[model samples]
Target: MVPQPFPRHIVDVAPSVGSTIWRYSDSFGLADPEAAEARLGLGEGGTPLMPGMGDLLLKVEFVNPTLSFKDRGAAVVVAHAIEQGAERLVCDSSGNAGTAVAAYSARAGVPCTVYVPAATSNAKTLQAEAHGAYVVRVDGDRAAAADAAEEAVGRGEGFYASHVWESSFLAGTKTFAFEVWEQLGRRAPERLVLPVGNGTLVLGAWLGFEELRLAGLVDEVPPITAVQAVGCAPIVAHATGRHFDPAPTIADGIAIAAPPRVAEIADAVADSAGEFMTVDDVEIADARRRLAEVGWYVEPTGAVAVAAAGQLGDRGGTTVVPLCGAGLKWPGP
Candidate 1:
């Protein structure tokens, strides 16, 4: 008998209401996030791993529920909390993650309060407000916002839906790897290229592939290649033998001066046989422009992967990249 096709994990879920997938191990009360997503027409993980520059398979995650890849995590995390009888949700997000949490929380009839830094772009802050999030314009920088949120969470003001530290979100995000493996006909990818702000995607994909391997689904975890903007690349510096300097960068989405999950990010990088690289702000801008020409409107940070993928020298065939966020999330043109 021939081997069954991969991605068949949901073959019987019908993807509609009253549908159920196999034992996909719903984490964070999102046991059915994928199913609920398919029915709601949120356009979840079914993103095209389409061909792109250098014939790479690019997963357009920007096409998610809130126009950024964070929807995967937000959807699962928020919905799970709703299922758990949670009332209010609090989060600290610069742009993408905040917007995602707001939208998903609204879907679940939960009040979402987001704390964004003073430097957060008007576009993102407005989007958060548009999604009915209690957008609190905090003072200081992104790191400061996290601290403020932490303090508030510690005070039991609300349930802190930390995008970085949420294990449920990490599990939901990892589905990207399973989808990628299936899209490639169950063949392991040559590489997984992406951008690292909070290192959410990298960690998710790594965990997902590990689960798949344990389930006898895949043979190995694909190599991860995460790229960061030179302006703020603490993880890259930590991984590439460079000095750690938490400077600001134009890629505000990935301008994580200090990520709460630093050690996990570093370990995930090494375990996946991955290497983190940094690119200049100018190069990021150029990728954004070029992607726009392809009708790929992504934020500067989202394009960092394209910049890094191009530099990888084409040895790894069938590269998988994700456009982590949409351009509309950026400030005014």
Candidate 2:
């Protein structure tokens, strides 16, 4: 019973957009056809292997359907949209998520509207547009665009496909941890490092392992090591006894100044042996370059885990890191 789980079906779309295209039908394809696809590698699971990043294994979840782990959740989101008989869908993504939702909506023959910050990366915005989604470029910051999208949806515009507060997306996203288990031969890691934004990767993976444990498929989830950009770490501020701080980091992906799921994110870290850390733009850039040199192209946000790894103490066991997004999604500086 994780908090606020989106219906298994609406994992991808935010409720602010339109009718959901997903359903709460089954577990990570435990005995279902879609689950089989998850195994058989039809661009489903099995992201990529970046061996020996540390004692922790690196699962390149960024390689999913839309070139990011977001695709997994987006699949659930769009599927539910169909079930709800939505005529169109709406979403506000800083980058990857909008592209993911738009692409999946196209696959399902559903129209999608994406609201993006005017400063959104060109590559990501282009990707969403290429997917046949109507791109709404709002003036002001990312949150402003999100607010506008919500308002539009509230006015009977379309499904919101809001990712921040949606719980189902986490359920869909949890599948990544299960894939990590299968990739690691069914053994849970001692620690999992993830780059946090709205708590998607952290929360999603947390729930996935819990579900597996409930089904007796695994024993326990490892303590998670969640990292964020120094400029935009709201939870880190909270963790360090700060009531609130204004974050403004260039690791734009995880530079979330305010997360609606703050309480939940903090609870997950505290409950597990997890700790949250932050890295600077220089560190984020360095990590990005290093990962790319290894042929693992990751965005600045995706590389925060790698940057944090440098500061982490010995946990004395395996740790798993989610290499979240593709570098290509970011346009040239």
TM-score of each: 0.88, 0.86
Question: What is the per-residue lDDT of model 2 for residues 1-333, given as tens digits with 9 covering 90 to 100?
Answer: 868966665356555321111222366333343542232222445565568555556788776767788877777666655556678899988888888888877877788999988888888888999989999999987888889899999999887776776565675687787777777778788888888888888888888787778889877767888887767778888777754445566677776667888889888887676888878889988888877887788877888898888678785777777788888877754
Best by TM-score: 1
lDDT of 1 at 169: 82
| lDDT (tens digit, per residue) of candidate 1 on 1-333 | 998786635345444432111124354345565555543224456667777555677788887778888877777777666656678898998888998889877766678899999879888888888879998878998888888888888887788888977787886688787778777898778788888889789889888888878888877787888788887888877777687556667788888888878778888878888888888877888888988888788888788899888788858577888888888877745
Clashes of 2: 29
Single out the weakest 10-residue window by summed lDDT for candidate 2. Answer: 16-25
Candidate 1 residue pairs that clash: 26-31
TM-score attained by model 1: 0.88
Error of 1 at 51 (Å): 1.0
